[model samples]
Target: MHAPALALGALFSATAAIAHLACIAIGAPAYRVMGAGERMARAAQAGRLQPALVTLAVAAMLSAWAGYAVSGAGVVGPWPFTRPALVLITVLYLARGLAFALLKPLFPGNSATFWWISSGLCLLIGLVHLYGLLAAP
Candidate 1:
């Protein structure tokens, strides 16, 4: 229940939710913004983006849940589940960051610079969440 944890979680979740929603609104065009190529965009336009966008939206909500949990809101649980969920969230983020950072093979269409920057940002986000969780009282 720390201020920094709450703030960071709120900020990250809000931005993530908004970004994912925007991507849903824009459909395939958003893929270009995400560093995906025209082919990927076309694929997304062909109806592949819906599922991914929805999943991302859910992930954003989960990030928000992490914020709430750390803020002592009692939104998801009693300790057993809450603590484990928080830990999972931290690991999830770290995994995402590393995969994006070192495993550029995930998005072949994306540019190296784009992957590096995005991955670095993801790593930073993960670290922030980790810090918030660890600092939680």
Candidate 2:
């Protein structure tokens, strides 16, 4: 079942989810440091709920992705559409990583540092997922 690679992918996703949650708890500076964009940071500083809410949603999604990965690894009970979910997650991460340069224009306010770091992390996670898929019986 390619347990190792899938487990690694799950770990990465879980870590990312934790990071997103941390950004919300740590407030504006955390948002800025995480390359969440100045708008989000400003909104956080102004005590608005939008930034936290959005970050929470992202964290939840990442957590779900992690669950899927773990399920594929057989570390957890099988989830509905596990194979398809893994495929979509892998594709999304790879695309986001590979297209960071192109995506920069769409998220103009995000720092270059953010795009580069996040893209690299995403690419690594995607590769792990791909390896797991390829190794599956």
lDDT of 1 at 98: 89
Regions more than 4 Å wrong, model 2: none
- lDDT by residue for model 1 over 1-137, one digit each (tens)? 44576457656655666666666667777867866556667777888855466547675775565565444434333555655666666677678778874567665777676676666766676787677777768
| Residues 1-137 of candidate 2: C-alpha lDDT, one tens digit per residue | 69999999999999999999999999999999999899989999999999999999999999999999999999989999999999999999999889998989998889989999999999999999999999999
lDDT of model 2, residue 113? 95
After TM-score superposition, the amount by which residue 61's alpha carbon in candidate 1 deviates from its true location, in angstroms, is 5.8
What's model 2's TM-score?
Answer: 0.97
Native-referenced Cα lDDT, model 2 = 0.96
Model 1 spans > 4 angstroms off: 47-80
Q: Which ten residues in a row have the lowest lDDT in candidate 1?
A: 69-78
Instruction: State every prediction's TM-score relative to the real structure.
Output: 0.70, 0.97
The C-alpha lDDT values of all candidates are 0.64, 0.96
